[model samples]
Target: MQVLRWDGGGPMLATRDSSTLTVLIGTFAVLWLLWAIKKQRKAAVHPLPPGPRGLPIVGYLPFVGTELHTKFHQLCGIYGPIYKVWLGNKLSIVISSPSLVKEVVRDQDAIFSNRDTNIVGRTITYGGADIALSLNCPNWKMLRKIFVREMLSPTNLDITLALRREEVRKTIRNVYDKKGTHIDLGDLAFITVMNAIMNMLWGGTLRGEEGAKFGAEFKHIFAELVMILGKPNVSDLFPALARFDLQGIRRKAKRISETIDRVLDYAIDKQIKSLAKAKEEGTTKTEQKDFLQVLLELSEQDDGAPSMIMTQIKALVFLS
Candidate 1:
């Protein structure tokens, strides 16, 4: 008889639960409405540049194919001379016209002087310690001043004249020796320039038989580095997934950086030993100063100017 009688409180309990659920649903809707209203108000206050709406997460990244320049040109036609493109979470404004380019680079240079560095660029430049990829700041300004006023000054260039001439003569001789064989002018030119740069940097050169072997290795590594840098990296587009490095660009960059770092370290060690030997022999005054020497001296200085670190020196030397 007790089981046959239904519990009337069961219905009441069910009704109470339904009512609680209703209240929660209404609260959620109210909160969502408030958020949407706030977002709309903010957008109204400062509207962004007109651009195509993208997908939820990937944005326009997928649509931009290998021919980025062509795709950008097409987008320019559709969106006007200047428009925004959402590459994942990052927003980039494309200024296709020359006038705007000049305005951004020349007229408002300081305002837009800072560069947006990617993962590969940061790695290659040793966390933007080099001038080319560094942010526009006091350290960058000091580095620029040193690079322009001291390192690449007419006096410094004149001092390195003999080094440059020696490399050029060696290159000419190498070309003459290889006249019978099929010549790659590009490789020759690259090696010549690299040798000249090394001479100016630390009074070294990648010439002769041993030097040719090293030069070839360097060329291959540099080409690989350049290819990786130019590739479309998912990590660059989606910063949240950067740690995952879906494309392995970061890993490649790190390996290349290590190889370059070793070469730089070897050169630096040799330079330091030479400098020390000169000082000990009382021939420091007679030793012709190279860019490395100048940078090393600057590193030792306690002048008001921002002091250069080993990383910066290496970055500058590598970049040069």
Candidate 2:
């Protein structure tokens, strides 16, 4: 018993161990306080939707299946027609049942008619100047009226139908010529539809290298836009994180916008020049009526003034 002497190193080692423990404890306390503060702030701003709790920061993003529509419908079955899910920090209200959809889309149309601004629509529609994607304000209403009255009216339907018939006939003729040869029906259909739309809008068909370039560009851009729109974005959920734009959505939108602007600018310039030439020669005729002529005439009138901007004209022309 007397041989059990005091070890001098014991106290020094104990002191070091205690110091490390203190540091770790302090760090943990600080982290916990910060987390509490964040939770308090979130709770103060917007009430969390009634739903299952999700993991920290990530929310229910990982639990969502590959097919969003299917997952949404499934969730609706469990949570009812109107259920909320978090992509990250943002909350998305899913409307699945037909009755709920009708109530929201039809009955409360005015309240819910505003367009959802996202990366893709902003890019593809020139910051949403196009009638289809633009905000549901007076400007949008004006454009919509113009589109309905001038471009897609019952009278104009005949123009579109005639062009469609001619295009289809030409496509059939081409297929007949290529009989027994391997051909893509989808591609032929796309070409026919695009040519018909273009002819109706501009009174001419896209052809040669320019046509090929425009077709490829439009298809590529449209595909990109569709893909983006079809997918729900994580950025939309977290407004604070939107500044980061983690998926490069904004960048892609800018690139698409620039490409579209270039093509549209050329088309507008050509149309303006044509209008000027026709005016100079007194050959501006309405017998060969088209969407452009109608829009120009409406632009000059103030009977139902809508403050139509040049950008609106460009957007309408591109869409037509």
The reply for model 1, stretches above 4 Å from the true place, is 1-45, 204-216, 285-288
Residue pairs in collision within model 1: none
lDDT tens per residue, model 2, 1-320: 12233588552224556668999999999999999999999888976445656788888888987887788777777878777786787667777779989998999988888856776666666688889888778888889898988778987666556556766787889999999999998889887777666656644333446655665677677677667677666567676777788888777777877887887676556666777787899886454345665566667678857667778877887776
Error of 2 at 72 (Å): 1.4
Weakest 10 consecutive residues of candidate 1 by summed lDDT = 1-10
Taking all chains together, the TM-score of candidate 2 against the true structure is 0.75
Q: Over the stretch 127-199, how does candidate 1's per-residue lDDT look in tens digits?
A: 9999998888888898999899889999888878887898899899998888889998897898898877766
Poorest 10 consecutive residues of model 2 by lDDT?
1-10
Candidate 2, lDDT over the whole model = 0.72
